[model samples]
Target: MNWLLVIVGAMVGAPLRYLTDRTVQSRHDSLFPWGTFTVNMAGCLVLGLLTGAAAAGAASSHLQLLLGTGLCGALTTYSTFSYETLRLAKEGAGRYAVANVAGSVAVGLAAAFAGAWLAG
Candidate 1:
């Protein structure tokens, strides 16, 4: 049952991730990976909300397994983030690489906290 839930969630999440990444990336002319950033932050916020809700007893373990473990796991891509940062650096866009790291960390944390607060 748990595996089924996770698979279903991933089935939805994977395509959502790809579509969202493409959609967000298309709008920007900059070399910075805005799509990856957006998805990561969104995933963090969603997981934060799920965690908070779980803590508050408003969410169940099944929900966490589905959305947090499966959906968020598929939605966020650390590999892509790392690859993009490395690509930026190798392409002589070191500043954007640094900014991407710094901004993603900072904003990701903030978004997670904000989501938790909102849910709680």
Candidate 2:
């Protein structure tokens, strides 16, 4: 049952991630990988909220497994982020690569902390 919940969450998250990436990327004219950035930050915020809610006993274990593990696991892609950054650097967009790495880490952490604080 728990596994099923996770699978169901992943089903939704994977497609949603792809759709969001496409939509965001389509709107951007740069090679900064805005789509991946948006999804990763969103996933971090959601997972943080889930964690805080779970800590406050507002979220069930199954819900955590579904949203945090399965949904976020599929929604956030470290490999893609890494690949994109590497590609940017190799393609002479070193500044964008640095910005992506630094901004993603800093903003992602801040978003996660903010979500956790707000939820808790």
Candidate 3:
């Protein structure tokens, strides 16, 4: 049952991530990997909201499993983000690569905080 949730969540989240990445990449002309940044920030927000809801006893364990373990695990993809950052660095876009890393971290944190506050 839990595994099913993870699989379903991954199915939804992965495509959403891909679409978001493609959309951002299409709009931006830079090699800064804005797609990764967007996804990570969005993922952080979702995770924070889930945490707040769980902490407030507004959600059940199964709901946590679905949202936190399944949805969040699927939504927050560190591997793709890392790969893109490295690719940018390897292509000699040092500043953009660094920005990708730093910006994602900073924005992700801020989004998470915002989501938690909103949910609370």
lDDT of 1 at 3: 98
Candidate with the larger TM-score of 2 and 3: 2
TM-score, one value per model = 0.98, 0.98, 0.91
Write one digit per residue (lDDT tens) for candidate 3, span 39-94: 78888999888778877888777777777777677767899889988998899988
RMSD of 3: 1.3
**Between which residue pairs do clashes occur in model 1?**
none
Candidate 1 wrongly placed segments (more than 4 Å): none
Q: Any runs in candidate 2 off by more than 4 Å, and if so which?
A: none
Steric clash pairs (candidate 2): none
Candidate 1's residue-wise lDDT over 1-120, tens digit each? 999889988988899899999999999999999999999999999988998898899999999999998899899999999999999999999999999999999999998998889899
Please rank every candidate by lDDT, starting with the best: 2, 1, 3
